[model samples]
Target: MHDEIARLARHVAPRRATRVASAGELAQPVLVVGSTLPVGQLEVIFRRPEVGSVAVQDDAAPTRTGIVTRAGLAAALTGRLGYGRAVLERRPTGAVADWSPLVVEQGTALADVAALAMARTAERRYDDVLVSGPAAWGAASTADVMRAVVAELAERSTHDPLTLLPGRSATWYALRHRCSLVRGGATRVVLVLLDVRDMSRLNAEHGQDAGDAVLAELAARIGAALPAGCEVGRVEGDGFAVLATLPAMDDIQAAASADALRQHVLAHLAAPSDGFDPAAWPALHSAAAWSVAGAADADELVAQAERRLRRERRAAVLV
Candidate 1:
């Protein structure tokens, strides 16, 4: 079992891995011009859609003498504040300017970037970080770092660790929300429950690795077969559910559409991947039940679907 688990770990998709954003990926464009250029040009530079900040180049030096931001430009426009005054009062001091950006190499981990961003935020400085790579510099803002962190956390919480599908909680929430919409007379919903027959027996005979492979493959096939707006989720061990919003139609049409979707999923699951032995592949059974907007609550719809699924599974076993 340990060997099988280790093999499954290596073979399963790495959907849970945290993604790192490179400095180059996060950088925005900066306006670079001579420091002596007219203050009027600052307005023009700020007007450019791509310019987020301006770098003033010294005539004699290879690097910028000061950086100008939109806020500095606004301050300059309101009064007779000259470029030199803006540089002295608004821009970072030479020492601070040198350290403000906190340059890092490309492909730095997002957590490291977030740490740097948090440090800067603590100091009340919102300067963009410069990412150095073989080609050019890229910029990363504190907001960007925070957004990545939030997205990573959300994915980990809402997705199944194994199948990478929506987990039970998210699935329940989606179904509940859809049921609410149906109750409002806005739409009809169909809930289809699918079960894998003899899944435990298959694991006992072929090992857990095969069982994992089957579940993963089943997830992929169901995702592919689902209609554009339908939601598929891993609701339990060896069980899956789909929440689909049916078009405005009579009960007969809605049932037909739901059955068609169920058959589509069953067809895909029946065709085992080339890697699996056909004789060892698990059988899939599905049952679908639909409710009009006002017919049932989310839990009731789920219960109805499960009852149908059990009936189908029993019939399949008896046959």
Candidate 2:
């Protein structure tokens, strides 16, 4: 995961940095200037002691003519002024469709940025202040870069290259988040830790490419098979973490559903084209599911699941 993130960061860092430089040019200088009168100077006037916004205009631009905040101005300047435009044009950022936030695109509108800020603020408790002007708006470029960097750094710091899934950091964060969510009235959360059996042997048998193919196959299969409202992330090169809240059912219904899901997954893995070889795949499996509605969170659940898996691995004498 570290390697994959580093590779992606290398690809995105240049573009992100350029955007940052552009935003800095617009907002930093304005914060240095203060609200005065200019058709195009856009400055932040003090509305509050520590909080303020900016306004700027692009009269000679090739497009629309109007006043906008420092935040909106970043997009405006990029659209009109042309300093950090290239970077924002190149990389846009947002959420993961089925999994995680992957990229940031340029055409993402000011309205969209504002909406995102609002959503993040509501969900994660953050302030969303819009600043106007080239300088104030320019600062948004830096914000984008920082967000990209955090996502990129998180990937680099905690993900496996072969599978492109969460590594240790992601797993830890997921566990922690699930625990928090559980405390907030979540009913049922399942903790699953999966270890590929005889992975090293397969790698040795088929060579590195074959090993990579196996890992990739597992990654793809799990991703495809993840249940609704469940988030499955890679925990290590050879292991995965699954956090999910299964709906409550009667004893028979619950057992049948769990069994069916397990069977379906096993069947999927057993198929030749599905990716992994059933013949050499690991046999020992450990599963533990518990209700979190009665508990504080998923921390203990995660610990129990990990402990169970470790015991199974030991019993199998897996090295």
Best by TM-score: 1
lDDT of 1 by residue, 1-319 (tens): 2221112111112234455455556666555566556665556667776666655556557554455556545654565655554443433223123223466677777667778767765543565566665654456666776777777678879988789898999998988877666675635777889978889899999899888988888898888876556778999998999877765667776677777777777877877788888877888878988886456488888888988888887898798
Candidates' lDDT values, in order? 0.68, 0.47
Predicted model with the maximum lDDT: 1
TM-score attained by model 1: 0.75
The lowest-lDDT stretch of 10 consecutive residues in candidate 1 is 4-13
TM of each candidate vs. truth? 0.75, 0.48
Model 1 C-alpha RMSD vs. true structure (Å) is 8.9
The parts of candidate 2 lying over 4 Å away from their true place are 1-143, 184-186, 250-260, 274-286, 307-319
